[model samples]
Target: MTDKETYQRFIDWFRRTWWDLPESVHLHPMIETYLTPEEVDLLTNIPHSSQGIEEIARTKGMAPETLEPRLRALANRGMIYESSREGSVRYRLNDSFFAMLRAALWPGRTDEATKNSAPHINRYFLDGWMDQYAEVHLKGLRALPIDRTIEDKREIMPHEDVVHVVDDKKYFCVTTCPCRHRHNLDPDMPDCPHPTEVCLHFDELAHYIVNNGLGREITREETRDILKKAADSGLVHGVSNWKDGVDTICNCCSCCCMWFESFHKLGHSASMDASNYRIQVRPETCKACALCVKRCPVDALQLRVSPQARNKFGKAAVLDPDRCIGCGVCSHKCPSQSLRLVPKDQAELTEPPRDPREYMKHYLADRKAAAAKNQNTAD
Candidate 1:
């Protein structure tokens, strides 16, 4: 095969691996922007799953030792994940393009390629994800709030406590929000004034970020401190959609978040389901301070005419279910505690797909079925 075919094959493999990802005509070129020609050839050598190099070595007519530098280079760049199995080292490609994009942005701790390529990479990556919006779509982080934010009459579950998730972690790492960082990089985009060191990582993910130069490991107390500041800034506390053993917490503002900006600014529909709880309003208690309105990331809460509103504001906080992400952002900011999170109509809040890959597979199947039915109807 020609070099062009070799590169195309690698791109095809990537598309198949990220099966849910939308096709970007510029994706292959964007990849070329980072990886050198030799590196691209090396990537084609690495299979989609974990494998030891001994067999590949024999096929290449060289010892695994000869490939060690290349293998280590790829692993250090966070392209392939390294693991130990039965005391032998094996490798596999990293789980998702989201992870790959970060590793690509940072390049290496010392690498200078990204100094200029960062802009191109960020722009192309955003475009690609938007083009194939669904496949590259993230299971959005669901916002969580402190117990004090809930109204006194509201039912608060121990499991629903945001701090509980924080306390349960054996490890923590703080990183700059990549979404915010990407925005700040572009001269055309408005700079985000929010604190940058607010991304909270946990467990194996913490270890991964620390090892990959994506984030710095930090003390638990520091982690808690950042969370506090994030709340004070009216940033939403969100965890990954995984219901159990969650590994991520992001303090998001609507302007800079991957989910919100894509939906609100870029015109891509948010593929994420709302959290289990939807926001509620007690008009009688509301001050209509519009604090919630200002803090609401999704414009879900509004100030409307109210006879019971306490001040000259002459309005009360009201929730529009159609607009709420169930993120609880408005609830966190309401001084009168008018907003509360209630278990969403279980029927309305369905479970998030376990992971992107499975989500894509299921999405394709559903689409195929729909298309077949439509064909029958047309006949």
Candidate 2:
């Protein structure tokens, strides 16, 4: 196919894929701004290898200045990356984007109906299954342990800083995974657009262990022991301890954490799902102690009791499962040990419900209603 035809096809595919994402998550303006027809053609038709801007511009019959901004913009948005060699820059699409494109264009791919049905299946059956699946399938993956012996901990290291040790055998660190950092492209800055790619130093295994908390079968003490070893090995910074069924490890630095960054940008409501479970507090066993209230990361716990009836321990803690992420942070702090993470089948992970079509309907209706209300007010 011609370069222009190839580019058009890719853009159509991207738009269709983008529509699948909720309206709440929109692409950066820079991405939209630089996705010109010519640029699109270049990106789609360009071979699966890096090409210098001058060569690309010359071949495409575009000026360097005209092409440079578009190239930089694409690079910044994590859609592409630039490599410097001999004072010239070569641009290539990020691996994640390329992979997605390939999958979208692959012959005999599943129909759109199957793709649309996936979320429903995931929400109902695959929610809890993913954790187990990831564990079983990925447990053998290698990762470098942060070198605790290194005195200078201040330097920002890539994911490769650690060396993987399995069965007392050391292995060379490798970057073989695609993370969110590789796919997110911010449009605001053209020259240094994409977020820093530190995939090489990211400790995915550490994150998985922390999130999964050793296992559901293990005791808190056993989990704590594992965390302590991880900390000692320099894999985790700060307090590396286990509480309840959750492992609480101090993850320092802002850029390294997806959860922290999501929490910062979108608030706790946006960051976590109300676990497919709810925490229950036994009032009789609960000494009106408010320990659980303080430990809740999302402020899902609150103290409630009449002032006259309040004992020396003050008000009892109550859990609002709607805001809980099932991290189980609250269970550790209860002095009376009244709080327990109990499974609640009724609770869902997503808000306004999980049906994408219904969600879109409601979202669109809400927007229309709000606009009408605004117009009425103006009148």
Candidate 3:
């Protein structure tokens, strides 16, 4: 293949792997900002599955001596994943989603390209890529409440405790959040002020981030501190859907985070897997302070007069079950102690996805099946 053909080949493959929306949308222009012609050629050589030096060295018309340095360069850039054990090297392009985006945004070593490429990348990613992502049943991420914020008096499930989740893991790391990083690119736009280095990773995923130079190793105490700081800043907490492969704790703010803004502001309906809980109110205890009303990400809380609390002066905060996603933001700040988390109806409870990879499989399969059945009825 010619050089242009080789570059286009990588684009085609990337579109297949990363941009799995409707065929009408074109992402090559946005994608090229992150991967240059040289980078694309290098990517086309690496297998999706991990392999050692011999396989990678054979690629791009180079022997091990010539290719080893190139492989190291790509590995350092987070373009590919590498694993070292027992004196052997393995390479693969395992993480291509926001992982590459994170690689391209961090201001570490070759950060100048990432720095220059960010605004174009952010514009399309925030506006265009997100629109496409929302159209698909991409259940790659979900909200999890900061366990302590949910009230010590409240029932805490194993999944509910973000700190417990960290303590359970032997390995952990923290990375500068990609969303916050992207938001700070433009001096013309007023950037968000929420904390940036709060994105947490665990286990092999933690190892993956640290080993690839994308993030730093963090202790369990440091993990809790990050979570606490995020909560204090009114940031929403989230994790990927898998129960076991729960590698990330995303501390997100509504102003810049896709997990919050896309779902709450952008009205993402094609998404799946919200928090396993929702908020309820004790109308009698509700002083109608509107703390919950203001803090709620979804505008799920509203104040209205309560008949039971005759002459309690004003109105009481009422729960809107349809609007609430059980993030625990309102409950944390409720002065009158009105708001609390309650389990959703059994039918509405979400079963966790197997892993990030399997999340798309199950979510897309269900969506496709639903669409087909709807079409049959229309016919």
Candidate 4:
């Protein structure tokens, strides 16, 4: 096949994974930017299931020694996952979703390849790639409310509490924020002013990242410190949208976060699922500082004149419930303690799925249903 056809073949293989690239989207720029024709050829033939080099090399009709370097190169580039067990090593092709995006940029490569690919990746995301999640209720991540920012701590669940989520983890690691890193690398995109190395991971995921040279290991104390710094800088703590075994916490900013960009720029319903909590305004003590209004990532809080206003401006923050993600970024910086996270009304709350598998199931089903509905309307 021609080089273009070879890359197309590789792109088609991504369909076998959980994320199916929309038919209307052309990813050739992204695919060609980071991957060489030879690398694409090798990836096209590799098995998705994990296997030892001896087994996989035999399939490619090359000696294990000959194929080992190629596989290692791919693993280093985040095209494949490398794992070791019982002193034995194995490899597997990465999926199109997290592995494709996270693995591609998490290491924070500033090389030309990464830089050139940034615009292509960013463009594709805006050009219908994220539309797939427009109707999916179970998003890939959810906001984790800042510690001590909740109105009533007694009502907070383990999953919703940022402190509890961090305490539950045994291992900790930090990596570059892929979302910000990608945009920062792109000359055409505006730089994200927030720090890049604020992404956190735990347990087996942390080990994998450290072992792969994708991130650095840190202590639990450092993890908390980083979270604190992120909160102080107006970053939202976003975790996987599941109740258990949460692998990651992204310090997200509205300017460069994949989810936020999708919501704010692309006009999606939400960047991710709002936490079970929502921000409650104490207008009486608001001071009319408008700090919360300025810090809110989602424009959820706006200043308005009200009878409850007591400050000089005669304006207090009012919440647009539909826009709040309950991230508590606004409340964390509130000078007068006028903003706090409160449990959403029972009728408005939606629990996250039990785990990643369940999240994927619900997400795919909803996306499929949305696609069908759109198709019907078009017809």
Candidate 2 residue lDDT tens string, 1-379: 7644654465554444212212211222212333455556656533346788777788668898887777666553334556666877676544422323211111112334223322332232222211211212111111122333232334412221222111122111211112222122212212222222111111332332222221123333433444344333222222111111111223222232323233443332233223333467766676776666655545678878744333565566776766665444556445666766554454342222323344445544654665587799999
lDDT string, candidate 1, 248-293, tens digits: 8888878877677766766665624466677888888887778888
Q: How far out, in Å, is residue 306 in model 2? A: 5.3
RMSD from true fold, candidate 2: 17.1
Q: Which stretches of candidate 1 lie over 4 Å from their true place?
A: 1-6, 19-25, 55-62, 105-112, 125-128, 131-140, 152-159, 345-379
Per-model clash counts, in order, read: 2, 13, 0, 0
Residue-level lDDT tens digits of model 4 in 134-186: 88877788999988688899877888888889999999999999899889987
TM for candidate 4 is 0.95
> Deviation in angstroms for 210 in model 1?
2.3
Q: Please say which candidate is ahead in TM-score: 3 or 4.
A: 4
TM-score of each: 0.81, 0.33, 0.85, 0.95
Candidate 3 lDDT (Cα, whole model)?
A: 0.69
**Model 2 ranges off by over 4 Å:** 1-270, 284-289, 306-311, 345-379
Model 1 C-alpha lDDT versus the unseen true structure: 0.67
Q: Candidate 3, after superposition: displacement of residue 254 in Å?
A: 1.5
Q: Give the whole-model CA lDDT for all candidates, comma-separated.
A: 0.67, 0.38, 0.69, 0.86
